[model samples]
Target chain A: MTMKRLINLKRTEARRIFITYSAVVIAYVIFQVMSSSGFLSSSMRGMLVPICAYMVMAVSLNLVVGISGELSLGHAGFMSIGAFSGVASAILMQSTITNAPVRLALAMIVGAIFAAIAGFLIGIPVLRLKGDYLAIVTLAFGEIIKSILNNFYFGVDAQGLHFSMLTDTTRLLKGGRLIIRGPMGISGIMKIATFPMGFILVMISLMVVFNLVNSRSGRAFMAIRDDRIAAESIGLDITKYKMMAFVTSAALAGAAGALFAMNYSTIVANKFDFNTSILILVFVVLGGQGNMLGSIIAAAALTVLPEKLRGFSDYRMLLYAIILIVTMLGTNNAEIREFFTKLNPFRRKEEA
Target chain B: MTKRIFTCALLILAMSSCAFGAPFKLGGTAPLTGGAAIYGTAARNGAAIAVEEINAKGGDIQFELRYEDDTHDAEKAVNAYNALKDWGMQLSLGSVTSKPCEATAAENFSDRIFALTPSASSAAVTEGKDNVFQMCFVDPNQGTASAQYIGEKGFAKKVAVIWKNDDVYSKGVYDTFIEAAPKYGLNIVSDTTFADGNDTDFSVQLTDAKDKGAELVFLPMYYQPASLILAQAQAMGYAPKWFGIDGMDGILTMEGFDKSLAEGVMLLTPFNADAKDELTVKFVAKYKEKHGEIPNQFAADGYDCVYAYYQALTQAKANADMSAEELCTKMIEQFTTMTFNGVTGENVKWSANGEVTKDPKGMVIKNGAYVGLD
Candidate 1:
């Protein structure tokens, strides 16, 4: 009976993976066909990359919030660091690397590396705190990052980088290419993020998150999340696993940031403020914790739904709020959940 | 037999609708229902009125105006651009703010669409774009004009600068002023900054400015914080000659604000609702009659953007039969060579890089209203 139960669990996991992947592949193919045949509207086509980027963000953030059971409010801070570092790298390497794809790939790697280091440094001190303390520290970290980026000005010269703050032009090297200016931010980034590239990044993020969640270390992390004192008594290295999840999450968020930044010509620090962090958090919460596929669906649907409802522009936000409240109530309310379960075709005969 | 006749009738109606000449459609994106709705609603009203007046004159090619609500978001602005493009619109009045304009123009310029923003003042909006244009002075232009005006009038030799630290617009103006002040024989005695939208008590910065014995104080920020600074400074008994740019225009109507705080404040702007000129009087009266309020600089800029487009279209000698691409090319060609006497200013020159060149006039607030300093 135990063997049969283990086999059943494995079968369910396999089935979930199969269903989610097949859906993604089928949707991608249909979108490609429609885009080529001119059946897709321009607005729909424009939404493709952003949707993919947001999906990656949601999935990675879920790893920390849902699986690890720790709330992080600084995801966008890591993203901003990643975006600026990646764009700065691209701008500096433009002379050396003539190929666009190769350049972008290298820049993304650099961004992920920088963002991971930052996460590791911040996680060391922050992991010591619990619950609201962690949340507040992360929030403060995010705001601090924004303020620093706002004052950060950098330009590239033949020698190296020239940096300044508070509009002091005296430090700028002669004839340097100013890449990041304070407040005005980065402008004129080359567009290299296509749908296919974004899809590959999402797949990579999903693989890392899924593998981590299924590993022995992942179980240890979840154990710590369920009962910190109990896990400590059980000799679990809670700090190590928590840092692992956090650094990995930050790295993935960085890659998404690179993709997002490359899609726009001009982007400022204000774009990745506290509101953006809350938006990503909303995606994770509404998607259901520890459900990767649900997060993807939520991100894609929410991003495109507003654009589709542009006809009723005035009531768009109101309708969106109503839909969110209804979905939450339907899923969480006990009576409604029971009523819906009764209508499920997959219910066992005895259970029915 | 009845079904066949119905299908044929439907086909004929569709073909005739396409063949008979449709009105030339122009699109725009505005923050119609968000925090910036005040500016966006005024812009929409101004554009609608311009189209109505133009079509009433009844030219061979009638114009149609359509706008999408972007809510001041960059992504939504791009979506709006794509939607407009799908609707066969090749000309636009705006994607109102700087960030949205940057996002839309970054990718859509290749579609051969002619876009003219009425109030996005950032130089980054149209840096290298060929088809996009701006109808307001860039930050540097206003900065230089402010310095030049103050120097020529000998307003003050010792000036103190206090601006928002984390804002693009405020920083842009402040940076230019810092560089140009010395050139105009003015000394920046005290330079300080505050985080915008966060700080309400600016006693430290104000006290420092007063202690420096500043003859004039420059506030290159919006009216909300500027009003707070004014009230606080008055309470603290520290008064200096306050100068600002167009960002301070809305201070007079600020809810529960002390109107006397702005009584002697001066600013650099292009439009004055109280101007006595014939065109100014006519536009102001018509706008008040229609909208029940005098138009702001943004509304004036919006109205002028439409007239500028029409003037360019006419100067190109574009006919009803011209394709959108041909008409766009003609419009671009005429924009470089001609100057239109617009409602905002006379001889407004549009450069190739999409910067608008017009002399910004100085104004002072008296009895809770803006009046021309000259």
Candidate 2:
């Protein structure tokens, strides 16, 4: 009976999950190949980490922006919270703590908590505001987080050691550490991240987001996105679902942020500026507003494009902007979408 | 999620701490793979070369070099630092950009993690932190050289300041040019600015300078700005003894600017690859063999920085399993008289402030290629 039920699962449901996951895995492999190739510029190779990190970011964001039908602009803020929490957790393990993995694990958890807290705080105020307002509130939250990071100070070191008078248990953050050295940033960290590590994290985050998005909750979220009034009329409990999506995405952003902070061995306040948030938006929007595979592709493509065009240097950005406009315009037209949709067998089956 | 990562980190840290004890683990954090990977890549390669040479020497202590890519972002620099610390690395080299440099200069990586940045020259790095050490010349030094050369040439009485305003590197150079050019008794009649790192053609700024009757203009910027400004200035026929900073080293070699129009442009470079010195000859040859091009300040800084880190490590591990703190202090002792015939020139002992107390050189763009004017 169980085997028969598994077999009887809707074709689209199984295909949606498999196709999305397979595409991500393949894209990352391609990215790895391109990064190792001799022709790929060194700058682009370095950008892969962010591409990896942002893939996680975009996917988690999709939980809110796409799957849940909510517009969030303050993802960078959650990332900031995750960074501080992760730094604090990592630093605590460094000084008083003995286990590296344990410290990192705890830091990741702490980062999620911080992100969840930040999400809740911002969600109540802005989630209620009608369309586009949520984005503005989230934008403000990102700025506020940056400002807080810039101004906050940790305790003075007794040993005058680089260790910010920060111990992981009591201290919310280690202000004086070399990695997230408060505003200027914490500098000079070791590389714990590789393609494998980044890919693993991205996969885990994607799986979690996918599970949440494909559930009954996910459909309700999508319903709201398509029409919030209709969803509420259908008794979808809009606020509860909105909060759920917001919190889930915040946690994922926090997770990615924590990993990113550890990846750099330094964290600076300015990096979480509005621009970083906007870049994530670009990834999600470029990929296809609600399309996970599209986001992953766009993220990987955009990350590597500038490197391929390094000879152009400053003009590379001009070319990228132009490409973005052209691609968006082309895809917005039904004829172009129809043309591409009919070309791929798998997608054609799904479309039919 | 945090619990899982913390568990793994603890497991790794425990293993690394036990495994890597006593050996000098030299690590670096730089933007090795990102938009600024060019800077970090050169730095990583240079560090690689130095680590190999030092390890090959086979001293009392063994050395392991671990490199972290910061992707030119400050947040990532912290992550790299944590990983190095977990690995029991006492001393580190790198952090190529001003943001990370400034972050460290604010007295972040001290005592436990000693740093000697190969590239960070922002004034902010040196302003506050005593632990942060820099090996390269500052933007002001480049600015001073240009201003002094222009003053010596008797180019013009009025000097103009035209540069990108929010760019820390260019602005640092511009401030130095304006302050020093006036100190040399030259009047700067016009000061013009542009937007972020994108502003190119300087026709408006050049015209303003020309209208202000400025005879010499100090354009301290990167290759993009240099290319646009030089071309536009030539078009406007506003040739006022074009002087520029060191950003013109590599990019100028293949730049499409009307070189014939820029016949008499003077540069106050610390050292040009085209110099006739034996060091320059050897460096340029090796650099071309390895990188297929001459070494710019970025490349030279990368090479010098790795060697400098090796020198410190070698001194620390001369006889004992000492900590990085002990090694860094001992480094200062050896630095008093240490001299390396760097790719640029004979760089002598470093000042306590990390500045290498040495004289620079003048390079003239004669026949379109940069050549040291003796």
Candidate 3:
């Protein structure tokens, strides 16, 4: 009887994964068809890659905030790290790696590695803190990263790469190219990110998150989240599980950051600030914590919502705030949640 | 359902009216709601006034001006550009800020759309983008011009430079000023830097310049920090001859600022509101009546951008029916060769590299009003 129940749970999980993958693939196919036929507006077309990047970000952030039940406010810091490192690597390999896709992949790998290292370092001390303290420290770390990037300068020349802080002390030889200028950030970057790459990144992120959530480590993370004392008595390595989730989330955010950074001609450190972390957190919360598919949908919808409201012009942001508030209230309200669950045909069948 | 249908019909009718209009669709982006909204609002007002004046004349160069809000963000600027493109925009005003302009300029170049920016002074906005032209002097140009003006006029032998090192505009001007100073026989005695958070205090920098026996201090930053620096210098009794660039144009009108402190403060600007020229008089009057205040250099630049476009389009014999790609070529040809006279400057010409070649005017504040220095 236990084996039968375990098989049923496995089957349900498989179906959930299948539904998510199919949904993404179907959406991609529809978007391509619409865009190719010129049915999609230029503004919507421009948002495709960014939407994918945001979806990945939301999914990864969900792993930490939803699955692990930890509130992180420094997610954008890892993203910033990834963006700069990815840009630097792409420029460094410009002559060596002529293939665009190969170079982008390598840049994302490098970005993810750098972000993972930062996450591990931060997680060591940060995991010790709980609740609001963790959130505050993460927020401080995000600001610190932004400040450092604001003063950091990097350049490339025939003599290779040079870096400096607080000044342009990287006085290079003739024909030297500045990769990053303090405050001004990096400009004149080759926009190599495409919608297909963004889609692939999102798929990979979802897969990683889903697999981790169903694994023993993911269970340990949830166990710690539910009851720390009980989890500790059960010999679950609390710190190890928490650190694993945090680092993995950071690595995914870094990859998304690389994709986002490469989509634009220029990027600045200020783009990934406290507001951006809050935005990703909002996505996780609104999508219902621990719901990966919901997170993806929420991210894409919210990203497109503002653009769709452009007809309202000046009042668009105000309207967006209103809608967000309403949605939050509706989702948190028990009666509304019960009504929605009753409206779902799948849930009805399960109950029957 | 009937109400929805009626609304849809009204929307279609409105869109059709826009489609049938003979006016050329002109689109641009600005920070209409952010910290830099002042500049964007001024530029939009100036451009609108110019468009109205041109359309009133019923010339072949009628324009339908549309300005979108970018909130001073580069990403939003690109999004705004795409929206404009979808609206069938032919000529572009680019963007009102330097960073956003740089972002949109890349898109304009790749898409073969001609863009003329008003107040985005960074060189990167036009660098390697032949179709992207500017009305205002580039940052390096202002720096070089400032150095030449002070050196040639013999304003001071020993000059000190205090600039915001973290800002691209300030740094660009400072880099060129130092390079050009030695050539003009100006000795830079002291050089100091400040960043965003630490810009409020300037005593250390002022004292350093004073101790170095400097007679003049050059500030290559905006009016906000310059105002604070001026007040701080006065408090410390280190009153040196103050010189600034175009970024200092709004100092006289800054809210709650003591106009007496700005007395005799000289700056190199493209437009002087106190100028007695007929075009300047007319524009200032119109802008003042509409905006309820004195129009700054950015407004003048916006006005000049529209008039320049008028001259180019009229001379090229361009029509409203021309595609953006065709207009792009015509604009490039005309802009590279034509000489334009507008409120900002006379005989304004653009190089193939898209930099404007116009002399900046030297003006000093007297009794809270700008008086021509030369």
Best candidate according to TM-score: 1
lDDT of 2 at B314: 59
Q: Candidate 1 residues B186-278, lDDT tens each? A: 999999888733679899889999999988989988788889888998999988889988778667755688889888999998988888888
Model 3 chain B lowest lDDT segment of ten: B15-24
Per-model root-mean-square deviation over C-alphas: 4.5, 13.8, 4.9
Question: For candidate 2, lDDT tens digit of each residue in B106-156?
Answer: 423444356777777765565544456677676677677677777776777
For model 2, residues A98-120, the per-residue Cα lDDT tens digits are 66556666677788888999888
Which parts of model 2 are misplaced by more than 4 Å? A1-64, A67-224, A228-275, A282-352, B1-26, B32-35, B44-68, B80-91, B104-111, B140-149, B200-203, B253-265, B307-322, B336-341, B345-347
Give the DockQ ranking, best first.
Answer: 1, 3, 2
Q: Can you give the DockQ of every candidate in the order shown?
A: 0.62, 0.06, 0.46
Residue A124 of model 3: what lDDT? Answer: 94
lDDT for predicted candidate 2 compared with the true structure: 0.68
DockQ for model 2 equals 0.06
